[model samples]
Target: PTLTAGTVKGNTAGAFGYKNTITTDNSYVVGSNSTISADNGMVLGNSATVTGANGLALGNNTKVANDNAVAIGNGSETAAAG
Candidate 1:
């Protein structure tokens, strides 16, 4: 079952923050303005985003845009899969 705790979208669980969104199953997002758009993605921190399957983004302004990618720390971005 999906468990959403704040303003969010999609079939996901453990989302808890304002304006956070998860667009695929098995995704989790936390922090304001965060978004996860792929399956098995996880994002944490303000303005973090995950756009690829099995991606992870952590810290403020972090982004992971490729499958199996991970981005951590503020202003981090992943450009290739790992």
Candidate 2:
């Protein structure tokens, strides 16, 4: 199951701002504009992005761009670990 819980008021993307999320199986995005593009990935903060399988991004603007990577701080990014 997929779940997204948040407010998108005044966001440029509007209610549709919750795009690009959970494209793969078992992925989850819990905030506005967060994205989880890989299987088993998770993005739990506003505008966070996770593009790698098993990756996790937990703060605003955080990004986990590589497989098995994790980013836990606001605006933090994980290096490509391929």
Candidate 3:
């Protein structure tokens, strides 16, 4: 399944606020308002953003904007630009 149980926003519009699906194969987004826009991306906390493939965001309001990037802790962001 694309989404398992207890997903606050799964396969439903207006929860993620983006055209892309909330979670794709090899991708995992596990928080309210988090986003993953590419493959192999992971968003682990609330309000996180991952715009690049193989990116990871792991806290509230964190952002990973480039490919093969990782952001850990709260509000962490990758310096690389997409």
Candidate 4:
């Protein structure tokens, strides 16, 4: 069961944009081409991605790739877990 406005798949996750996808429980994705693939992850900008549990990515092309990490600002990326 997912709440979606675009391409999405997850148990109780939400995705709301073109090509957005959430693939883990309690995750959320928004903006075009964004993706969230871990539990409690969230992405909220174009091309943003979150690939670790409890991670967050916010801004264009931002990425969070470790557990409890957060990436903010355009083109930002996390280099280590939080």
Per TM-score, the best of the predicted structures is 4
lDDT of 3 at 46: 81
Per-residue CA lDDT of model 4 for 1-82, tens digit only, reads: 3344565567778777777877788888777888888899988889988887899898999989899989999999999733
**Total clashes in model 2, counting residue pairs 3 or more apart in sequence or in different chains:** 0
Best by lDDT: 4
Compose the digit string of candidate 1's lDDT tens values, residues 14-63: 68777777778888876778888888998879899888889988899998
The C-alpha lDDT values of all candidates are 0.80, 0.69, 0.67, 0.82
Clashing pairs in 2: none
For all candidates, what are the clash counts? 0, 0, 0, 0
Q: Candidates ranked by TM-score, best first?
A: 4, 1, 2, 3
lDDT score for candidate 3 against the true structure: 0.67
Off by over 4 Å in 2: 1-20
- Model 1 spans > 4 angstroms off: 1-9
1 versus 2: better lDDT goes to: 1
lDDT score for residue 68 of model 4: 92
How would you encode candidate 2's per-residue C-alpha lDDT over 29-82 as one tens digit per residue? 666777666778767788887788889888899989899999998999998644
